[model samples]
Target chain A: MRNELDQQLASAASEAQAAAQTLDGSAVAPSRNEPDTAHPSASVSPQAPAEERPRHRCVELGRAVVITSGKGGVGKTTVTANLGTALADAGKRVVVVDADVGLRNLDVVMGLENRIRKHSLDVIEGHASLDEALVRDRVRKMLALLPAAQNRDKDEIAPEAMRALVAELQERFDFVLIDCPAGIEQGFRNAVAGAQEAIIVTTPEVSAVRDADRVAGLLSGAIAPKLILNRIRPQLVKRGSMLNVDDVLDILRLELIGVVPDDKDVIVATNRGAPVVDIAGSETGAAFRRIAARMLGEALPIPALSDRSPWFARMFASLPFGKRSSTRGS
Target chain B: MMDANVFVVTSGKGGVGKTTTTANIGAALAKLGKQVVLVDADIGLRNLDLVLGLEKRIVYDVVDVIEGRCQPRQALIKDKRIAGLYLLPAAQTKEKESVSESQMEHMTHALAGQFDAVLIDCPAGIEHGFRNAIAGASQAVVVTMPEVAAIRDADRILGMLGSRRARVLINRIRPEMVKSGDMLSVDDVREILGREILGIVPDDEEIIDATNRGQPVVLDGARRLGAVYSTIGRRLLGEDIPYVELPNDGLWLQLRKMMAGLR
Candidate 1:
């Protein structure tokens, strides 16, 4: 048993080295116009024309980004689907991996549920190749999904195995977004294993905020996590009845990437098995676009939702009669 | 003396008011003249003692009793305000793995012989701490709110507590939102969870104040949610009382009722 395990490790190491060498070989040939400088394989020149530079270096290879929330029903899957679609819509080759093994929902949300024949477990067990397991989106050419095995327990895929699977995907895709299962247990650990970054989805509720804080703490050391405050109610925030984006950011103390409003279109889009980003005129969809833009290092202004109350309502509340009427609003 | 009725208050998701429900229900039961003891099973994050206003008087906790550092009776702290209420606090420094299932069962059984009701406040998540919380309890109260995520977690918890006489307690419900079809209705929660309704707690700001002031809302007896908790306590003791109708049933509620009648 020990010898078999040792052989597997040795083969995996060599396979990684070979894959790295192949990537270097292709990247080095494009830079032949330049001098054979020190560390030719290490640094890909930035001056190499836009189309000629390695696509892997555009974002960084094997950059696994895990989207997780410690509490259930906080729209982690929704955020994953929308972000993946938005990123793909931006013309980046993206594959969203469902790491919630037994309770998979990312496929359904992405409208790729009908396309899945094999799954991540099949890829890990060597029963199927990564391309065979990956289900491409019907509408989006660049977006794909690696669905989780519906019947398999989360323990079937260890963190190390998940890391290897993600590494393989990273070689092919520009962005790998992992939809993590809700909890701080084996499933959470497995989802975060291969990811270089994390995006935590939370609502304005105290419970959701508290759970997000816990998840942020857990992912602090290994992964650079950013926050996405989902389902924000601007009216409630204006009335001081609910936690706003700033309040949530203060408590979680993570960099804010997105603030999606409580838009009804999100539910409609999900029921249709399409990402909210595909639905036109959705505020939530616009929010997701801003998030994707921010992920690409665009300095878009964070939309101010706190002052969304109507001018009439604001003016009335300041008046004595308006004060009496506004009390009923809360 | 009657054998104590042990109840475990649990919700698979965190921050769904499990500890708050445990503290209030235990206090309400004791207010009705039943000897009650609240057990905090969330070892590391102990909040039941603070909720019950008994944090400063704690000398030993459930861990000490299970590890034989103190007697079970020695660890039970008497409530300062309530006459028949007591608390078996969880250890703040100990991890959840420190207490085993069998040890929790043994301790709860010993306390069952002394108190009229034992309410164990289970931690969040369906993990080891959850197993320890429900070890010796004969029934479970699964608490949740009207959100989709909370209901899903409650459904998962109900599946885990199979054949354990579990009932649903819907917490922080907004009747106005329900009437306007903005939030989930009681029937919606019932259909999703598929469990018998234990009670419905309205979203009240006073509950937060009560917790911060180290007092149970049921002690006030005048607050809206306070009355609901007391009614639930009596219902648990075999009283058949209908749930209180929330106030402000305006035209929206009438329209909703008419729509329901048409359906």
Candidate 2:
């Protein structure tokens, strides 16, 4: 009975694989033609001179950014989900890829885990197509997720394969945000392989800062990464108990892209399997929106913790060392 | 004679007190009359010598011994304060790739034959450096803080340790925070990592001062942290000592209990 069951399961898997391959073969071929009519830039390709091909291709490709932290649970996935949702809310097509492999959480955090039909490993292993692997977000039409295989190890998908997948995704989406696994290992290298830019996420702690410094040094040769300081408690900073934004900047020496204050709402939203940006009246959601705007090259005033404090506290905040200027653009 | 045990002190995330733990535990073990040798496996960032207050006496390092430039005995620095405590310093100028796994394994085995315990200070991250550090050890001690990030990395490291005689050393735990549910409790960490508890070291500012002064906390004798490390040493020696309990954070603890009761 066991042998018969195993045989049936194997045959069913093979049948599904064959069906997926057929679907993928058609899906991959027609996407290019489908985009030609939808995108005006593609129409310019036939009319453009041969000399402008390289420049046109560069304009057509989207930016690929990897969010990473050498320390785990410093909110790399949370930042990726919020940033992707915020970008999608701004009407930009976005795809967030979970590159953490065995410890996949981006899909759950994005509230699209149950909808996963195909995973990144399936696409890389030729069992599924990119379209089959990409799960469109239920609430947000502009956002999609390329979920990682939960059961697969980090070595299942090589860096070269991830690069190819990211390159293909870059041609279709406006922003490709890859959520990197913690630690500078095979998974981290794979996450950063195809990305043009990097965002280092860290919390206001000595351990996180040191790991971020190490990660920054490793990523220095490949991409000049921007730093996102997450989980900052203003009250603790004021008490001089925690490392402030400037202290972190002094250690990391990277462009400060965003500062996300610690809020209970973030944990609540994460527990509910929704990005904090989807929660109404979330301060962290507003922070993520500001980060997205800053990424788009918008010059907005940095939100101040003192603005939410009492009037008496604002007077003490005016001290030179207490106040921080808005992070200037790179 | 019983076989000498080897333990590798590692935490996947940096700055979680791996080197400090190694130094203090070595000193504590030596204080307990066990011959101990602490190996610094963080080649590029040599900190074990500095933590042991033997930085200036380092004429030879682990790489020098591994490359046959000097005898392992010559590279080992004896601590004058703690009898039978020695440190095999790492080469600051050399990268992690300078030392191979086989060389480290052979060196550790040779040292284990002479000492009662060999503690290898593994570098942060699960890279080549980490692999080289753990290759020699028969046991592993994963140091982590009470924060979610450190616990997550500890879980990953524990997963990598995989069937090795590994114990979780919860370091820098702020009891007040844990009591108030602001920080992860020992129960929470135990549940997540599912490892046997070695000990919990309280978050103490004196540890930083002790590190800066090149004095291991175990040498202080008077500090609570010194007692904590000594207790950890006793536990490693197969003694059953209960963890140190901190004073409650008063009304916050009551409020949290009431909140739990409501739930």
Compare the candidates by lDDT and give the number of the best one: 2
Instruction: Grade the docking of candidate 2.
Output: incorrect
Candidate 2 lDDT, tens digit per residue, B69-102?
A: 9999999999999899999988866777777888
Please list the C-alpha lDDT of all candidates, in the order they appear.
0.73, 0.74
RMSD of each: 10.7, 10.9
List A-chain TM-scores for all predictions. Answer: 0.76, 0.77
Deviation in Å, model 1, residue A280 alpha carbon: 5.0
Clashes of 2: 0
Q: Native-contact fraction for each model?
A: 0.04, 0.05
lDDT of 1 by residue, A250-318 (tens): 456788898998876765576567788777788899899789868866688897654422432342233
Q: Candidate 1's residue-wise lDDT over B4-121, tens digit each?
A: 3888999876667887899898988988898999999877657687677677688999999999999988999988788899999988667778989988988888889888899999
Candidate 1 global lDDT: 0.73
Candidate 2 residue B174 Cα shift, in angstroms, is: 6.9
Interface root mean square deviation per prediction: 8.5, 7.5
Residue A299 accuracy (lDDT) in model 1: 84
Alpha-carbon TM-score of each model against the true structure: 0.70, 0.69
User: Which pairs of residues collide in candidate 2?
Assistant: none
